[model samples]
Target chain A: MSVPVCVLGLGLIGGSLMRAARAAGRSVYGYNRSGGPVAAAQADGYDVSSDLGAVLSRAQAEGALLVVAVPMPAVNTVLQAIATTARDCPLTDVVSVKGPVADLVRDHGLDGRYVGGHPMAGTAESGWAAGFAELFRGATWVVSADEGRDPVVWAEVARLALDCGAAVVPAESQEHDDAAARISHLPHLFAETLALSGVRGGNLTLALAAGSFRDGTRVAGTSPALVDAMCEANAAALLRVLDEALETLAAARTALAAGSTSELTESGFAAHQKYLERGGRPSITGIVPGDHEWLARLRDAGRRGEALLTLPREVS
Target chain B: MSVPVCVLGLGLIGGSLMRAARAAGRSVYGYNRSGGPVAAAQADGYDVSSDLGAVLSRAQAEGALLVVAVPMPAVNTVLQAIATTARDCPLTDVVSVKGPVADLVRDHGLDGRYVGGHPMAGTAESGWAAGFAELFRGATWVVSADEGRDPVVWAEVARLALDCGAAVVPAESQEHDDAAARISHLPHLFAETLALSGVRGGNLTLALAAGSFRDGTRVAGTSPALVDAMCEANAAALLRVLDEALETLAAARTALAAGSTSELTESGFAAHQKYLERGGRPSITGIVPGDHEWLARLRDAGRRGEALLTLPREVS
Candidate 1:
């Protein structure tokens, strides 16, 4: 029998979970503190509730897997609410920077049932209105199941991510946090930094700004509170990455100051080439056969990723 | 009768100019030191020449527009060649940065028929093979026509840019350099800096790298010589922008260190919200207006831009 699924928060991630789970043939329920999202979800034919007791009752009745898709700071509050309900069913979360939330979970003693999961995909957009059923499609959904997590809970959470069309990316809690820091959190800092510099530029300079600024600083537009929570949650790892980035910038600055276009260009190009050379281990390795397929997809991702990362296309 | 065109270099930009102009109902001719690009242009059914006398003969024969598309270090050599040809044809260049080249023209007393032009577009890919006929379409072709350039020459140059589907943007030499520094040049430095920092991380950290790192450093992949020339040519402006970027980053760091999430988030969110609020600018606007029916295309471009920059959609 299929386990039911309950999505907490009803924001972008939460709403996505509810819709995708339903599409995957699971009985899905949604819980949000506000009636607006719940009402909207309900109108979309979802089993949704604003009341905590009612949500718990639905999850309990359906033997659902509880997904905490709330923001990092609010994870504890939801966990506390869940603690009172005494719902013993398996649980998981979609919080981005996981260390603090995992620590919070440990502090509250919910490790047995809760798995930390983060889908490595998002846009600057947020909310129930922004929710789509296929947001996690072909994206890496990192599931960080610590030693204390129940195997059954782990399997169910993995299945949930899979059902949502995401690759089940398994990791240790610390590993996930550190990895996110290198890739996700630190980029935000660079982006914010890049944009903040432009704020002081002349109005004409800012107006004449083109694709690069927009692409380079895309992440700076993300939620400040969330970014802060993320950075604070994963401070140690983020700082290390930041140091490396600063050093790189310093080296580049020195090179630029020296006026060697060839050397600077080669250095920059070499770094990018190195990145393409040492690429990602995709979340869905088994969806296709052989490492070649993985390479091909990674290459495709990199190519398309270029359009997203820089200008859409050259002006021709 | 129109003044003769004498394109001094037969590389990608010059070759593309010959092809695009011919296609747009204009007579075209080209000259290259090496027989290679000129040979290729001739083979591609355009009028081109390797012999200086032959190039002079063609320029005097057809009296078409001249485009000097060569590297920064090579621009003076081409100007010297132009001196030797002693042709009265109106001339312009497709150089990336124009200040030094323009200065060289004035210094060498070749500014009478010479106007500085830069087609603000190209790929990391270069060479004759990389020269597409439509490369400058929808691109901003900056024409830096100083006092010495004849008005008739300026109008013809503008007409060439228009024929090639480019917007004729006018700016002084220093203004163009400064603008390129902010829009074209600084982004490269930022990208390089980000990539260099990212690649220097520990192996474990590098393994965890994701979209943000990739996006932030995409421009780091371009040819180094080109980047170097850009940095060297626009040194003053590039330095100023770099300092500004560093300051911005330092401020952001300070905010982060002080746990000022509100300030960080406010700035970050405001940046993104402004992009969303601005609606979307057409990708092809400055490149291919007037010559095409662009309303529907512009609207679509705007929609995609909005989708890219606006709020992140919820994935369920």
Candidate 2:
């Protein structure tokens, strides 16, 4: 039988992971710190509770994979429990950043079994009702293939991602954090500034705001506390990318302030075209965890925009 | 009978205007510079042709309203034709920027009968096949109410916007340009730089890019020449707004580099909430062209997030 899955928190990401794993025909259950979401998850006939110790104890007994699915702030408390109770379980996480979680895991001496994982899926909503079985469908799940990672547990994490309908992207913790800073965290900063600038333009400007403003500022609607935590956790990588973006915009501003149009427009447009062309053009070959030189092969695949499902791999 | 509509340059905005005006039961036709789109428009039963001079002469004879619908580069040519052929026709345009068009109209000495109008609607797709009668349904159309404006021509332009199923947003030429620079042009700069930065992060970063990247870079897919022209024409106002955006981002970068979350996050989030609240909230009342102090009243209404459709106005 497939190994059972245990989720630590029943918020949007955790609850959704529980539902998605169960739908894949795996024995999945969860735990919530609040009574409300626990009752809601249990009503759906899944094993869930407000008891963290009991859940970890049961997971240890059943040899189930323990998935830490909490916000950035709560990850530390959860890690403390796993250190004493289920330290040998195949461990992974669904946090937004990988490096900090890796740090916490190492601090707790759980690094031997820990593999950093981040699924590229979520919404602004929270709690049990907001989650479903399809949150990670067709999404990319980044799993850290750091040096000395156990082949067995690496394959386990990758297999879970594939079963949950996500194609696994093998990356080192720092590399994943750097990429996330570019593609996700930097965009959040832009969205926040863009939204505030529109409002500052007064009513007419805000009224003239249509599709571009709406789409560009959509993420700014996300909770400030959530955005703050994510940015803070990934600050170092984010700072590098944020510098490049500012330099580009500053160049445009300089050219405009002079008597010329932006020098960045033509090349920026070409880059935009290249981005559109890259979508769905898979280049990864046969590669999987546990194979000789698998981490290097997987990193090469990621560079070519390949995911696990792009080619067949022997999971057994 | 209604005043017939004469549109020049049968591209996306022009072609769609021809279809939408006809659907609203106004006598409508258009002119194109090329034989291909002209034939396609003609085959679709639109009265379109390659003869700009002939169309303008006929519009002069029939006392029709002339709508100049062309890209930024082509506006000057169309305005010159209007100067000699249809100088007395009630005139307006649907170009992306208003101040530059107003300057061009004044240069042609057609300012007496001209009302600068811009319908806030379009798609990336161009040519006859991309247009439909429903393109302008429920969109906002900004009509300039500059000082010494003729009330009769103003109302006539406002009437055409109303018939196209767009609510008239009365604004001065410079005011409209300033607002547009904040909400539209600055965002284009951001999108262009953003798309380039994501691609610059190398292949793995580009591969991991998701919803935020997609939406943030969507407008970068627009034609580069077009974006350049729009930004160039409104450089002064855009310069002001660009400074504000850069200042905000630089502050963010400094804070992040110094081990802190973005100081802009909280205020930016609140501003986003206000933007959401502003949508569909109307306050304009008893205001239209030719009424005493109508321009000031409309400006005040615009500040309250109001449009012409919010209350009744006698058009005739």
Candidate 3:
């Protein structure tokens, strides 16, 4: 029989993981710091506990897999508790960023038992009430590995991701952070800025926004607390990507101001078309390259009004 | 009986207008410079003619309403032709910018018979084949009128908008341009710039761009020729709005750099929440005031973490 899985923190991600595990016919236990989430999970017909120590002890005794799905600020405290109380069980996490968590596991001498993970999926909603068993279906879940890490723990994490209906993508923690900054964090920042701009334009702008404005600013509607925490955690990486984006925007503005917008317009159209054609898959294989040569290729293709590259399908 | 309508130019907007008018049980005639759009409209069982003079003569003879639905570059030529051939018929045009078209109507001495119009609706796709009778359903069709303009013509335009299942919003030509700059043109510019930035981030950014990125940059996927024409026509107004948007973005960036992002975050969240609460309607009535007091109010609400204002429902 497969090992029992204990999920700590019964928020959206944690609750959804437990639900998926239960649906897959695996034994699952849930724990939350608050009595409300714990009671709610129990009401949902899942085994849950509010007492952290008792849950950790049960996990250790059952040789269970422990999944930490807390917000970033509470991650270290939970990790410390796990190190002391559930050291014998395999551990993994579902957090947005992996580098800091990976460092914490190494610092606590728990690297051998811990696998850093991030499921690249979410909606604007949160909390246990907003979660469902199929939240991670067809999602890409990144599993971070390093030298001296336990291969068995990594395998178990990948298996768990598959069980949750997610595709497993293995990478180093730093690689995941860089990619996350570019694709996820940077977009969130843009959405926030765009939202502010829309507000400044007053009501008419909002009324006229249509599909693009709504889509562009959708993430800005996320909780302010969550936006702050995520941005703060990855400030440096987000800044780097923001700076790059600013440069591109400035260049386009310059081209527009100079009455030579054709080049910029062509490039924008080409890249956007390519993005649609690929169905939103990453253009390169493995980790994203720092050089960004694909951008130049897109601009050239746009200028020529032809497709120059064929994007590969993402590995499921 | 309601006046028969004749639609010049059988592109997406023109074809859709013809289809909508026909669906409303109003007789319609379609005309195009090229044989292709004419033949396509005819195949759809629409009465179409390639001879512009014959169509305009018939429209004037029958006192039928004439709609000029063409791109910005071709608008003036069509206006000139209508001025000479169909001077007695009421005229309206579905162009993106209203100010220039209004000016042309005055210049052609057709102010009494002409109304400037812009329906705030479209998809990335274009052309006769992409036309649908319901394309304008629930959309806001802005009708621009000036003092001393024919009230009958304006009422007929509103009737036409209603027949297309769209709401009629009346405003001055310049007012329509200003509002369009903020809500429509500004968003399109931002989408293009964001698309360029995504291209620069390489394949990973594109792949990782889930809902927000796709939604934000959706307008960038529009046809390049159309993008160029629209931006060029509204360059001054668009640039003014862009400058305002850039200032807001700069402030947010500065806050982030100073490690004090709370203010920006709060404002973004407030605006976003308000956007959702209001169902994306403009908060104010009449012409959106030049001074944006609502933004400050949103920021204050966000800072206090309370709903301090109720957004007004949009007038249909």
TM-score for all predictions? Answer: 0.80, 0.91, 0.81
Regions more than 4 Å wrong, model 3: A1-3, A25-27, A57-64, A86-89, A107-109, A146-148, A279-316, B1-4, B43-45, B57-64, B87-89, B107-109, B199-209, B279-316
User: Best candidate, TM-score-wise?
Assistant: 2
Per-residue C-alpha lDDT of model 1 across residues A182-283, encoded as one tens digit per residue: 667777876776665554443323444567777777777777877887887677666666666666666667767787556556776887888778755432
Q: Which clashing pairs does model 3 show?
A: A283-B203
- Name the best candidate (by DockQ): 2
Query: How far is B202's C-alpha from truth in model 2 (Å)?
Result: 3.0
TM-score of chain B of each: 0.80, 0.94, 0.85
lDDT of 3 by residue, A149-182 (tens): 5656766776788788876555566656766776
Docking class of 3: acceptable
Writing each residue's lDDT as its tens digit, candidate 1 over B1-316 gives 3344556676667767767777777656667778777677778887667777767656655655667777888878767766666556677888877788888887777778777787776766766767777987876676663444565566677677877887655556666677677666777877876666656554434555667887888888877777888788777777777777676666656665666546655675676555435442323333232224322332243223311111112210
- The Cα error of candidate 3 at residue B26, in Å, is 3.5
TM-score of chain B of 3: 0.85
Docking outcome class, model 2? medium
> Model 2: per-residue lDDT, tens digit, B154-192?
888878888888888888888888888877888788888
DockQ for every model comes to 0.23, 0.64, 0.28
B148: Cα error in model 3, Å: 4.6
DockQ value for model 1: 0.23
Model 2: per-residue Cα lDDT over A33-53, one tens digit each: 889999988888889998999
